[model samples]
Target: MKDIAIVAYQQSDGVSDAGAVNEVELIMPVLDRTFEQARLDSAQDVDFVCSGSCDYLQGAAFAFVAGVDALGAVPPIKESHVEMDAAWALYESILKIRMGHADSALIYGFGKSSPGELPIVLSQQLDPYYLAPQWVDSISLAAMQARLMLDQGLITERDMAEVVSRSRRNARSNPHAQLAGDVSPEDVLAQETYLSPLRKADCCPVSDGASAVVIATVEKAKEWGLPYAIISGIDHRIETHNLGMRDLTDSVSTRTAAEHAGMHDGKVDVAELYAPFSHQEIILTRALGLGEETSINPSGGVLAGNLMMASGLSRIGEVFNRIVSGEAQRGVAHTTSGPCLQHNLVTVLEKA
Candidate 1:
């Protein structure tokens, strides 16, 4: 409920695969740049460190432990980790600032999707005892959701192709985007489907990347004398883990999170939505009550390149970039997890 804002953000050069660089190696420069942009020194200025990343993507449990090295965390700065996306960690970091426990918070998320079978590995996020054993890859589950939407007339293949075309075209302006620039619905329709109702272009390309954001209290933000985007609201929620138990066409979690996060209070000038599958973008936009007038995914969003744990954080970074650069006065950034938008986080940001 207290005021907190993001004053700085930075990211790695997203690639399809980052084989030679280790996790710490991948994140160090990004971490340094984030602090530098914030006009703060790493050890002296940062009061807390909270990060979001996954163990599965790295193929090792406790993978985030190594990320502490990037922080140069000696003398023990306050820290925590979430198994969810880094955007979720931003929620935690801001909460820390609100609690008056820390004046400033550093948040980051990173992942390398190329190390193993990403889709196969993501199956573990399902009901482990039941659904996961069925080996339900992420794309297959998303395909089922897309089919349900089409069956009910929520969206069409043409609608999906349009989303892909617009999103990739938008990505051309984003230097960090892995895939960007012009493509047509007809050309996309010509591509082979990886899953029924979900073509390759309709889904995000796998990417290896890292992202970082700095959060500060209002007074600290002012004292730092840097550009800042105030956090208006933040919330996240989860739905039933069993995909079959819920409505595949709608994301109840997103609607609930948006309500709690107050995303509908006013018109959002821009949005950074984490829709890995094009159909999911349709569902999310509907859930958030965003119309054609709203600027969706100006930074190209996760559909251009989804780097697992880092994509959500990247959504936050995109919005922060817009606010800091005076391009948008207000925006909403959203992130999702599990199969078919099973979990969602929404945050409202405003420029001062």
Candidate 2:
């Protein structure tokens, strides 16, 4: 495979509701910033363009087609779309470069989740015959998983609260974060539970926003004359859909993906994990065998502000940013899809 480097990354400030901003409006500004970061002009500059989004969010078929308006494909461009998170779109772009079909590519993800019942809409992604018919919302499913962990003695409510407190504290420095500030575990524990074992503070807010990244081959990066982070390794794994069949307290798929991605090949300086819930962070940390030496979620992660489809890609961007900024020599970025961390992708990046 060809060595790939992420050259540019950009994201909008996450908001609770982008009231009047349509999907195209949410995507255009981020795209413009990404192009500028990469020292490019437009979609015409990249060999390929790919996006990640869900039509269910728009309640319309081919809703992602409307997002093309942001790209200004008037001259026509090579592009594609994925129903999954933008991290998967990044994977597709990597494959294109590896095949020598493209030298550089643009990837972005967007979501306006405030327009619909976000969790309920996500329920449709579950098994239609079993889980979907019962309308088991995402948060509720997470709560079930949390309860299982709690019962198994793997974690505690206090432990979960600490994760929330750290996320809010870490987010204080992040301009794009929707939730930030200092909050104690006691404070989070004091709040009433939104769903039995899960407090409102434990859940990621429903957010509307977008994120974009520009990646190219190492030779292409040298040609562009930009600071870049090499994607040393990347791999993804998924578990069985039946929630009962798998261990809810552990992230087996994450462990497998991390292993295959060469996460432990060298010392890890930082990690950006797409853990939407507080408890999930603990699970990922243990699964990856990350010790105190590694900084986790310096961007506050998804618990600060989840952009749905975009947050996954943002994980890779966050690690790349840290590496290029000299804060870390190497790092790992993780993205997840499906309920209860059923699917996971892991990418290891090093400074170029």
Candidate 3:
């Protein structure tokens, strides 16, 4: 496979609620900035475009189609859309780049969860016939996962609080994070629970956000003088859709994706993992074989603020940020979709 690299990335500041800004107004500038940072003109340098987003967020079908207009499609750019997160779309774009069908590509993901009841909408992602009717919200599902982890002795309630404290504390330095501050595991534990074992602090706040990345082949990266990070390997896998059919304490899909992406080959310099809940991060860290030496979610990660479809892509953009800023030579970013880690994607990146 041809080597593909992320050449540019940009993200909008995540907010608790992005008022009345339409998706186009919110994303157009980000798209423009990403292409500019890549040192490429959108209409000239880009060969294909792929996006990750969901219709449920907007309460309308084809919500992603309008976001595509942010690319200024009068010239008719090659494009596709995924009902999943933008990282999955990025994965598709990478496949195209590897095929020699395109040298450079752009990918974007957007989510605005503020206008309506966020959790209610996410419940629809479950099986329509069996799960949707139950209306199990995202936080409760995460709480279930947390309870299982607790039962397995993989983590404790105190550990969950610590994860929340650390993630939000790290967000203080991140200008784009929606939640950031210092709190104690004891303080978090003392808070009221939204669901037993899951407090408000443990749950990611609903957010409005968007993010994008520009990727190019090795030859094209040299041509544009773009800061590049090699796409060493990319892979994703799916697990049994029914939460009851699988072990809730661990993510098998994440393990498969990491192994397929060759994450265990050598020492990893850094990692950007997309885990909206603190427990999921623990599960992912174990599955990816990431230990104390590996820097995980230096960008504060999704627990600071999860804009649904945008969180996964934002993780990719975070690793690209590290590469371009000369922080490390090698890294990995992982993304997930569906309930309780039903789908997972992993990408290995290196600065050359």
Put down candidate 1 lDDT per residue, 1-352, tens digits, no spaces.
Answer: 5678888888887799898888899888888898889877784578888888888887888889998888888777889999889888888877777787888888899998889888899888777788889998998988988999999988989999999998899999988888888998898988988888899999899899899988888788899898899888889999987777899888889999989988888778899999999998888998899987678999788878887887888888789899888888889999988888888999888887
Say which candidate scores most in TM-score. Answer: 2
TM-score between model 1 and native: 0.97
Residue-by-residue lDDT tens digits, candidate 3, 1-352:
7778888888888898889888898788788888778876674568989988888787777888789778878767889988889998888998888788898889889988787788788888889999899999877888898889888898988888888888888889888998888888999999988887888888778888798888888888999886788888889999988788899888888888888898788678888888878888888888887888888888788888887787888887888788878887788999988887788999888887
Which candidate number would show the highest lDDT if scored against the true structure? 2
TM-score of every model? 0.97, 0.99, 0.97
How far does residue 275 in candidate 1 sit from its true spot (Å)?
0.5
Superposed Cα deviation of residue 173, candidate 2 (Å):
0.8
Clashing pairs in 1: none
Determine which window of 10 residues in candidate 1 has minimal summed lDDT: 39-48
If the candidates were sorted by their TM-score against the true structure, best first, what order would they fall in? 2, 1, 3
lDDT of 2 by residue, 13-59 (tens): 99999999888999999999999999999999999999999888877
Off by over 4 Å in 1: none
Q: Candidates ranked by lDDT, best first? A: 2, 1, 3
